[model samples]
Target chain A: MAFASSRSRPDPAAAPDGPAYLPSSVRNMVKLVVAGGLGVGKTTLIRSVSETRSLHTEEVMTAPSSRVDSLAFTPRKTHTTVTMDFGRLTLGESGETVLYLFGTPGQARFRQAWLDTAYGARGALVLMDLRRPEVSYEAMDLVEESGMPYAVAVNDFPGSPVLDAATVRADLDLHPETPLLFCNALERESSIDALIGLVSHSLDVYRRNTGP
Target chain B: MSRRRDPVRITPAYLATGGRTSARRALPDVLTRLVRVDGRAAASLSPPQHHLLTAVDGGDLTLADAAGHLRLPVSAVRILAGDLLDLGLIQAVEPAELPDVELLENVLDGLRKLKKPA
Candidate 1:
């Protein structure tokens, strides 16, 4: 009950897999995160797979927070975000199940917002930069800590050295059961596969958790 | 008058009320929608509140989308939406209970379909 406060953390049972129910009045709306380090194809993956141009919502950073939160800023930038990049993906011919991709602002200040966005989400597609493995650690760490199920997709950026999954997984120290994938975030099919990999892993976790 | 603009100013929506933080105790999830918006929805609403009612009139939009389109913060949207909900011009889409078996099944089946070669 300690975590039940509305301003505080959301109940995991409420979701991270899918909404508890789909209202007949609304199409089945699902939110999934495309998250990772800055420029790890998080936005690109969403754009590549999204049915529409992504939308964004932002929150102004408090004066002190602007100085501290975003390391990417050059002292002039001011907005922290409540991210909502509404990218709709139709799942089947009937168009019954629609997935909404929410692109996360991959900075630490936006960490809580990232976790909040993951509510009602099936899972997070955590992209990793093979060349800059260190950049992904913070993003992965938050996802891990949030108890949000995720699949790590190593972006097959041009000029990135070819490496095997096992070696990289070991280097990242990721839980073995967590799915790891290699995807070129540029291609629509490849990006979609990375998302499918995450959904598949989340389904397994749900079955494991919700099963007897 | 010396002209100066801080890149980010406190929004008129928030300023017209009090402040943003404590005004929205009744608000639930940030993605919560205003299910109905009619004439009664316009009563006693500040400009931001009116804008929220107008934004979600016919569309199924989350509080975040409203805030994005309106250039308001999530907190501000929550406050304004609360006023509209109280006016009976809007209603929150009821959330379902957890551990939903059928919903999980649908999502799993959907993902499997997406995985198939196309």
Candidate 2:
């Protein structure tokens, strides 16, 4: 994956010393990030919600022997997301408004970028594959570590066991308020609705916790 | 229009002063001008750039370092860096020296050898 860089230096005529200001009217945009493990259908979820061009951010997956056991499985898996994946969406029909959706790399080795992506995010949608529910823990640790509230989207893979929400909650040991729902990521409506549910739930939680 | 030249008039006292005061006074003025001009253009973050920017806002990585660390191709990172540079979200520091291609080739060659059945 190519990391996008600026080909030319900043124009001297336009160079500013500080952050450019957006009008206050445009400042209310919302950002929602979709984070999950590799092959967990994060890309599919974003594409389903917003077909707009998504930024393909790829990071080298390095095997960190100090953390996870890199040699346990295939020797071929090299280079992980040192960065993050990104996509964009517009909530409702107002084209003027926008939602920035970022897909964080799931491996524990890429925790630096994952934590970075979670910064300033109101919440996150942690996608889980029911077949390997154990994998959900790493993603959960990231959200919890970052102190960002999150909702879980269980991607129901075909032929995978369909566990009830109660069982999933128990297996994952989720707090009562955390939103957990099943989704067929391959289906557009299902994936999009899953995101909508997450965002709405997160907003409610934020409002209640912060008051107003 | 006829040109009129003023007679050269430099006193010993003026020469001794060495024009240092005037040059020193202009330094701050020039610096302030540069800051004001650069500040306005630095604020807006493009969507994808914003994601990348937010990822690095913690100051853990420099722009090029972030790009290399991310394993994104240099060109793509260059493009994103340009956007970030323009918005003043990030500043370009010196580029890291390229790693030794020969060393990398040797390492890969060794890995290839390891994969072969003994």
Candidate 3:
């Protein structure tokens, strides 16, 4: 089903409440982390592949409230709210499985929050902008610390530098086994390819860990 | 109703969880997918517990989604869910192990099928 210049029109499938609930057949719910710096297209990639409209949820930091309490003895308290965008993708013929993509920041400031988001995740899809490759270092390190498999997807932006995969790998100081690929985050197929790379790599890791 | 009129209306955390700060088992995170298992429990639930169950009634929604839907802090939601779990009113779908090899393969196959043609 192709449309002429479909980008110009809103997608009915992307309606915020299109399907109020997951199909009853769903049994397994898997999660993957979409981590990157601000403006690295985490949400864009999620929107591209997500079956439903992306949803945003907030994680409130409770520590700051006490600090603000001592400052002025005021009733008002301050809390740092970090918003995470996520979307759902139902799989299997009966839609018995569902995958969730959670868009999260890879910064150190949200280390505590990562405990909640990264928990029980299968892997991480760390998006990088080759023009500013330095921004992805924290994300890579964070994923490594979590001990889960992660793949780096270089999201190509206009006028971004085009370096060979090996050079980019060395620049990012990535492990040899870590999968690195490129994709245009705005394109659904391209983004799915990136996710495919990550999940395949995760399968390889799982095999290596569990033995034949 | 206005922030100016009532600057800070703090609902003590204990009020939400009956002074139970921690659950018997590890708490489910925001991403944990939860579903209502015992519909009959609705009749005996407190208001907060009822809202949590209602939030997950028809579908398997993530804890974060329930928090957002209920307009409650994620921490409160965790505690509320913990109580629900103790009562066997709800269940989380997360597996004890990392998504197994078969599941990963299924995800890969699904992604391949959903890919748009170039």
Best by DockQ: 3
lDDT digits (tens) for residues A36-139 of candidate 3? 88899999999887766676656565543323322343235445656788877877677777888988887766665665778878899999998887787777
Candidate 3 lDDT at A24 equals 65
DockQ of 3: 0.38
Model 1 C-alpha lDDT versus the unseen true structure: 0.64
What is candidate 2's CA lDDT for residue A16? 22
Give each candidate's fraction of reference contacts reproduced.
0.23, 0.04, 0.44
Order candidates by lDDT, high to low: 3, 1, 2
- TM-score (chain A only) for the predictions, listed in order: 0.77, 0.74, 0.86
- State which candidate, 2 or 3, has the greater lDDT: 3
List model 1 lDDT by residue over B45-93, tens digit each: 6666666676677565666556656666665677777777767778776
Interface RMSD of 3: 3.4
lDDT of 2 by residue, B8-96 (tens): 21222112122111221211110011111233433555444554565455343333233333334322344555555555555543211
- Per-candidate DockQ values are 0.24, 0.03, 0.38
Candidate 2 regions with alpha-carbon error over 4 angstroms? A1-27, A59-83, B1-118
DockQ of 2: 0.03
Error of 1 at A66 (Å): 13
lDDT of each: 0.64, 0.51, 0.74
Better of 1 and 3 by DockQ: 3
lDDT of 2 by residue, A1-212 (tens): 00111112133235221222222222123456687777788887776544343444443334542323433344667433344555444333223333556776556656754654555565688999888767767877878787776889999888788788899899889999889988877665576667666756665666566564
Cα deviation of A142 in candidate 3 (Å)? Answer: 0.8
